[model samples]
Target chain A: MTDKKEVFGMRFGQTAGGCAAAVLVAAMLAACTSSSTSSQSSSTSAPAGSNGTVIKIGVELPLSGGDAANGIPTNNGVLLAVEEANKAGVPGGFTFADDSLDDAVQGAHDPAQGAQNTKNFISDSAVLAMVGPFNSNVAKAEIPLTNDAELAEISPSNTNPGLTLGDDAKKLRTSHPDIDSYFRVCTTDDKQGAAGAQFARKLGFKKVFIVDDNETYGKGLADVFDAAFRKAGGSVLGHEHLTKNQQDFKALLTKAHSLGPDFIYYGGTTVTGGGLLRKQMADAGMGSIPYVGGDGISDDTFLKQAGSMANNSYYTVAAPEASKLASAKGFIAAYKAKFKSDVGPYSANAYTAAKIEIAAILKALQADGNKLPTRAEVRKNVAATKNFVSPIGNVGFDANGDTTAPILSIYKISGGKAQFVDQINLKT
Target chain B: MDIFLQQLVNGLSLGGIYALIALGYTMVYGIIELINFAHGDIYTLGTFVSLAVLLGLGVSGEVHGFTLVWVVLLTIVTAMLLCGIVGVLIERLAYRRLRNAPRLAPLITAIGVSFILENAMQLWRGPTPIAFPAVIPNPSLQFGGVEIAAKQILVVVLAFVMMAGLQLFIYRTKMGKAMRATAQDRDAAQLMGININTTIALTFLIGSALAGAAGFISGVYYQSTWFFNGFEAGLKAFTAAVLGGIGNVAGAMLGGFVIGLVEAFATQFIPQGAQWTNVVVFSVLVLVLVFRPSGLLGEALPEKV
Candidate 1:
């Protein structure tokens, strides 16, 4: 019996040792392959201009994961802007090429992979700016690295208020003091959340139950909504946090039903429990109550997943309706003709971000008089962007590196599509 | 009181599903003395297969009445059969060789199988949570100011029937006797003319079938399933198994229901319970293990010489 115990212990030790060795080897191999691939791609991506100067803009997005629905369209938008810029030509005659990187590892936005992609972008001297990282969590990881390198990154759809300004903003700045390096065309959660609260009050929902996916973006938005709703003379019945990607919300919904709230508010994207929560709420006999959410739930995926339950739901988006904007008509038609699909949620914002970046690059080039501007010069130009007109609206960056034109468009789900209801111009 | 009763019904329905999964964990662990960690992924695979079958049968957009019943029944059967075969194959290919080669070998192999199954499903379905069509039309039956949906009824009834059937099969048949004997002593059972390999395979087959049923019910009831669904469910079910006594069949079932009730009541009564549901459930496990180490129904197994 003693010998048997000893042998068992030995075997356990061997297994642990073996597993450790295997993990270390796998890590090393992954690093080696990623480095090699980045170098090869960078070398091949350099397009030959008239003067032999090629500039690349790194596009980091979760191209093949749960966020792919948003990421792929956003990538296409960036690609379209780059195509147009190449055709239009920069002042220095430098060729613009897109070096798109998929920061998704194991079918999700992995922070380590996002950080690695940032490093790859920083290492390549010709790459000037980056546009991407649809999800706020991925933005959180990539921002610090870009900040340290003084590389400018503009996200089309990161709505977490903490990333730009607020108490969390101060915390973020303390970690990476180069806070101005990160910019987003998309409005923050505070504006969207406050807009949603005002809309709820406008719709006369007195008591509301809030549920969040408990991630950085969802929880932050929910907190903002909760505070804003209370301050607006609306009573909050209850607040609940749910695990992301959780299919079942019956128990939570059942509890919510008992409270008898006027409506339900979800703070998360469609992929992360928003759609299922709506469906389950309907299943729990709350089908008639209107559901409200931020821009995260303002997508075709939410409409498809929520099915019939989507009818009375409302969501807020940072951009105006594509049809409403005269400048967006051309981009929308071109996007449809090229992609064979309607422009997704962040595609227009991504296009606007790319255009903004291109305009900054042009400014830098013209300042230097037909000479290539340094990355720092490009970063400065991007920060100083003001009164620049784009397809979305008048694009500009404020003191906090947030968009000056922060418009929150509310859409109601009717006929299984998000229809424009009202628009709120938020004060920066 | 109505709210409490309503929460009870909700808890029971959720418990029923967990009980079904916990049975698989207990049964496999009882016989092989190895925790089959891949069992949850097997449940996930069952949901995927059922989803594919339902889609193939063109059961889309508001399936109702007899057609709904038939489609659901057929999907469950197909999912169970496929999952059972897969389970047996996993046991044969992976666990068979490592049966006597240290306890750690089979355990590690089970985890490895789990990763393979999860990654394979992710590749096949693309990491996003696919909207499972609500095949079972939800019609709540109101009684005494409490609401109980048809899906909950279906889940509870089917789970009880499966559990009863499993109870009978394990205690009353020749194959069942062989299985019991193998669980007691594998070499000794082989000497008594029992086909040890077949008995072990049968154990895996039955356990996986129950998990498959669980997967089907959850997918249909919740109207969504993702690749990582199994991991969380598996962890909870494993907790149930340990709570009930890791190797006791009845204990596992009881533990599952207990955990389910705990989670439901926690969400209903505790402040911020929805966020603390997992915390409460695991706390119950810790408390139970502290008070009753051998589990509520577990009899300490005789030490092997």
Candidate 2:
């Protein structure tokens, strides 16, 4: 009996050990296979057999996280621009290649990963210009690193004005000093938030309740909107700050409902409980009141997730509607044919940013007598961008690397789609 | 007073969910002494399964009346059955051999199983929170000043029925006696001809079915479900189990209700309480544990010679 028990124990121990080893091996293999496949796809998509020198444009975005809903479409827009540029050829026989990196850590944008990605791009000599680090917080972590390298970084979706101006900008420049290295296609939140407030006032909403996701982008927008709305003679009923990724908002909504506001404004992205908040607000008998948000909540994911509750909600996007732009016709058609999906909120901005970067690179190459210009020369050319017409509109960078488009469009979610409602062109 | 009453209703409905999930943790821990961390993911899987069933039934758009009732009943039954089978499979494949090994081994395996389920769901249905079909109408009824929704009533009533049914099964059946015998003394029960594996598997089945019910009800009530929902809900339910007494079913239920009420009132009254809700909930757990180590209902086990 003792011998039988000993044999049984030994066999069971070996089986368990073997099972664990098998699991480890399987997990490692899955990781390896996934990485290899992604690299293979990126390489296969590049233009083949070009005799020109290969220059890479690194696109950093949260391709796999909660922000992927925004990042993937933005990346596609960048890719489309790169493909168009390569087919048309740059000024100096330079072939543009897109090297996309995911700065998402465990399904959300991580600043550390963004910094590391920037360092990798800065270290690569072939990289001429960079297109994105989608979120403003990610850009905050990456700007100093790119500035140290004097690499020109253009963002397609970052909207926080503090990234380009204000105390945060001062803090960023105090260490790096090369503040002009960063630029974005989207207009700043100061303008967008004011526009949102203006739109609300036009709709005759006197009392508004404000809620923010408590992130850099959300809080800044909420503060600006609160000030602007009050300045426009609208009364602020209440303001609340919610932590990101919170699923429950019933208590907050209940509190807000008691205030009896004419409208509710959410300063947050769709991923971080915006859709849930809207749905719950509707469920709490607040559906008749108008809901307004910034560009963050202007994605299809929000529309689908919010379902019937999405109706009557207003969102502001920094870029004009793509279909309305005559220059965007071909790009939109090609995008639809290739991706089999509607062009998202920031795709036009991304396409515009990529084109501007390519235009600057071409200008630098031409200025350098058909040789690849230094990173500093590229930065100077991008900063000197003037009257560069693209799909979205005229693109130019001000002294502080802010877009000078002066255009913000308001969209209403009607019939489960973002339909263009109005445009406010600020007199700059 | 009306606001307080409304919050109280919300607290009870939310507590019912935590209690259902905590029962899974308490029962499994009672028998195996292993905190089955994967129990939460099983709950998530239960939600996804029900989502798939609803989608497959072509019950999209607005469903109503007897049809809505049948659809919900079908979803609950299907999710419970599927999750029960999944629970048994996980125990047999991943946990059975580790049962006799060191305690740390099964604990680690439980975590591993959790990752596997979470990732599997993430891969199957992308990482985004999918909208759960709102088949049940959520119109509120006002009584005096208190407001109550139909979904909240369903959640609380269904939870209590399942809990009562589980208690009855554990107390009144021959299998329940065998399970009690095994939990009391595994070797002695085996010597007395009770199949140890069967009893353990039954524990997993019942626990997982309760988790499934919780998941289904939550998906309906919240109108959303995601892969990571299990992680937060699991942590809260585990705290509930510990707060009640890890091995006591009734204690787990009471602990869940207390935690829920605490969260609701804290969010309502405390300034910026939404930001500090988790802190307040866990602090209560710590205070409870510090004062009563055996939990509110748990009897201290006699020290072995």
| Best model number under TM-score | 1
The sequence of per-residue lDDT tens digits that candidate 1 reaches over residues B1-305 is: 98888888888888878888888888888888889999999998888988999899987756878887889789999999999999999999999999989888899999999999999999999876776777877778999878898888888787677767776887798887787789888999999999989999999998998888888888887777889889988988898889988877778878888988888899889877788888888888888889998787763244434
lDDT by residue for model 2 (A113-142), tens = 989988888888888789887777778888
Q: Write the per-residue lDDT of candidate 1 for residues A1-428, one digit (tens) a residue.
A: 22222222122112211222342243233333333433344456556544257778898876664445445666778878888998886665588877888877886666678889889999988788999776666677777777777788998877666678866555555445745788988776667788999899999889999999887667777898999999999999999998544456778888999899999999877777888889878767898999999766765556667888888998776555555678789998887676555565567888888888888888888888978778888888899998778887888898788999887778788777566798787765
Instruction: Give each model's whole-structure lDDT.
Output: 0.78, 0.78
| Model 1 stretches astray by more than 4 angstroms | A1-163, A166-182, A243-247, A299-301, A326-382, B61-70, B300-305
Q: Give the docking tier of candidate 2.
A: acceptable
Write one digit per residue (lDDT tens) for candidate 2, span B64-159: 889988998999999999999999999999999998999999999999999999999999999777898887877888888677888878877876
What is model 2's DockQ versus the real complex? 0.33
> CAPRI band of model 1?
acceptable
Total backbone collisions, model 1 = 0
DockQ of each: 0.42, 0.33
